[model samples]
Target: MRILVCGAGGQVGHEVVNRAPGFGLVALGRNRQQLDVSSPEQIAREIQEQRPGLIINAAAYTHVDNAETHAEQAYAVNRDGAANLAAAACQAGIPLLHLSTDYVFAGDARAAYRESDHTAPTGVYGASKLAGEQAIAARQPAHLILRTSWVYGVHGHNFVKTMLRLGRQRDALGVVSDQIGCPTQAGSIAGVLLELASRYARQGTLEWGLYHYSGQPSCSWYDFAGEIFRQAHELGLIERLPQLSPILTAQYPTPARRPAWSVLDCSRFEAAFGLAPRDWHADLGEVLVELSRLERRPLEAGVRRA
Candidate 1:
């Protein structure tokens, strides 16, 4: 089956492209240069040329802090780009799998967020993503909107990489503990996408709607950073462990407000697909191992910036 993946350069997209062949899929991943999601014309041209059986959109303006100042660009890519892809998929009669974020919720709920929970985005990034969700739902009936949180991987700039860089550079580091969420691995998320794509290819249709998926056993940023350091030290990527300080979100204010509790309830997805959420600690260790293997030479040079 032919699968077209947008944002091929991103962490999740890169994983999807790299792993697609194992699933017996012919995947054509396009970066912004090959296919700009923000441009309807370019999307149409790519779709027409590729004629893929399935479409997975991983493109988005994901910089939460920068999205505040670049609201137009955010909406253009997240909202308009999603709409364009969904509409094109609808026209081509193909199933669309769109990756989303957990930030769509206001994060005040006492328990984990369900797919049916009321959405109240607290920042421009969330707002734009929510808008994209709405646009995709309205434009295309055959679409899977998978929302995940705190994604980190070897390929891109994410929380795990940031923690490693800081842990290597500074003797001590402070991370926000009050704000909590699932630290999902991009490889895991890509695996989920591939599973759905494979099913869609075989069945021709799926129970298409909104779904929530993330790593199991959610933790605060401080806990996540500590775990990263622990794994890095074990892998010999970081020679010395730094003192990690647990601080409140107020201590480190950013341009955008983050959800206090962004843990997603992935039961709906598990029950529907028979795929259980993986433990994050084991996944984190795997990521650290891969990072260590990839950066062994660089780490030998005294920790180069990723």
Candidate 2:
């Protein structure tokens, strides 16, 4: 079956497109020109052109700090854009699977969050994504929304990449330790999406309306960054292991507030698909290997600055 993938160049989107062929898929993105999802007309036109049996929307306005100022843009893309895409997919008589985040929770639970938990987002980004979930559910019936947390991949500007880049420049670094969440690999999430697609092509509708997915272990940002640097040091990629000083969320303030506990329970996904993601650190090694290989290529000779 032909599936259309939006947000095709993002961390998850990049992984999904590269591996989509495993599920007999045809992917499409905004191209370099940038497809604006706020416009329903553009979505309709694209749906007519691609004629995909399924639509996986990985596109989103993901700048957390920027969303505090540009909330209108975030809502337009995350909420309204999802609605537009779902409407288009429903018109085409197909299933729409969208990716969401764990930010929908208040993070006050002090433990892993289940699918049945209540949502009280503290930031514009989370609220906007939750709105997107609601919009899709309201607009269409054949939909599967997967909410994940602490997503990182080989390609995008993610937490792991930032730690490696900034960690080398500093003699020591400060990371927030109080907050906890899962460190999901983009490749694992991509694999999960493909598995869902296979089931959609087979049984057509899943039992759950929403599901949570990520790697096996969950930890704080400080631990996650520390591991990234540790692995980099092991690979001899860096000169030294920068001292990681753990701090609290209040110590490292940002415009957008993150949940103190953003961890998601993946029981629903595992039970439904019988799939479990790999360890976060194991996936980190793969990324480093890929980055190292890319560093040696002549085409990317000068691109490996960090």
Candidate 3:
């Protein structure tokens, strides 16, 4: 069966295309140039022509800080674009797997947020994503909203890549320690999506609702950066490590207000799919190896697995 993956050029989308074939499925990936979700006509035409067994909507305006200024652009892609896909999926009578974010919550909760938790987004990016969730829920009956956080992968730009880049350039770096969330890997999310796609492609139905899947042992961004450098050094990717300074969120201000506590409860997803939680730190090591290979730098002996 053919599975249509939007945002094929993105981190998760790229992983989905790479992993889909392993599930005995044909993956049809459409980047922005091939499919613009904001335009319903374009979406409808592509869906009609491709006639995919399932649709995975991974497209979104993910620039958290830039969304503060480009509210319209963010909404056009995240909210309206999502609605268009949901509507088209409804017409096609197929299941839609839409990826979401943890920013949908207000970020003030003391505990991890559940799927049933009330949403109160702090920034335009979160608000737009929340609107997209609402649109998909309202338009499609067969849909799965997979909300993930702090997603990083070898295929695209993310926090891990950012830390590696900055660490190489500077002797000391400061990262926010106040905000804490689960760091997820794009490959893990892709695996779940492909599993769900394979199931839906065969059965044509599922529970159809929102779910969460993130890496285990949530930590602050500061901790995450420290772990990245440690793994890089252990992998022999770097000779010298920079001093990582933990600072308050206010020390590094952005246009968007990130969630202070955005870790998600993944029990619902685990119960339904039976997919085990992934270790982000362990996955980070594998990612470093993949990235090193991509950069044409081979790792030294005695490299540690993530």
Q: Which stretches of candidate 3 lie over 4 Å from their true place?
A: 297-306
Alpha-carbon TM-score of each model against the true structure: 0.96, 0.94, 0.96
Best by lDDT: 1
Could you give candidate 3's per-residue lDDT for residues 1-306 as a string of tens digits? 999999999999999999998999999999988999999999899988999988998999999999999999999999999999999999998889999999999999988889999999999999999999999999998999999999999988999999888887889999999998999999989999999998887787887899999998899999999999999888766777999888998888887998999899999999998887898888888899988775653224445443
lDDT (CA) for every model shown?
Answer: 0.92, 0.85, 0.91
Looking at model 3, how many pairs of residues clash?
1
Number of backbone collisions per candidate: 0, 0, 1
Q: How accurate is candidate 1 locally (lDDT)?
A: 0.92
Better of 1 and 2 by TM-score: 1
> What TM-score, to 2 decimals, does candidate 3 have?
0.96
| TM-score-superior candidate, 2 or 3 | 3
Candidate order (TM-score): 1, 3, 2
lDDT of 2 by residue, 41-61 (tens): 887887788777888889988
- Per-candidate RMSD vs. true structure? 2.1, 1.9, 3.6
Cα lDDT of model 1 by residue, 221-264, tens digit: 99999889988898998889999889998899999999999999
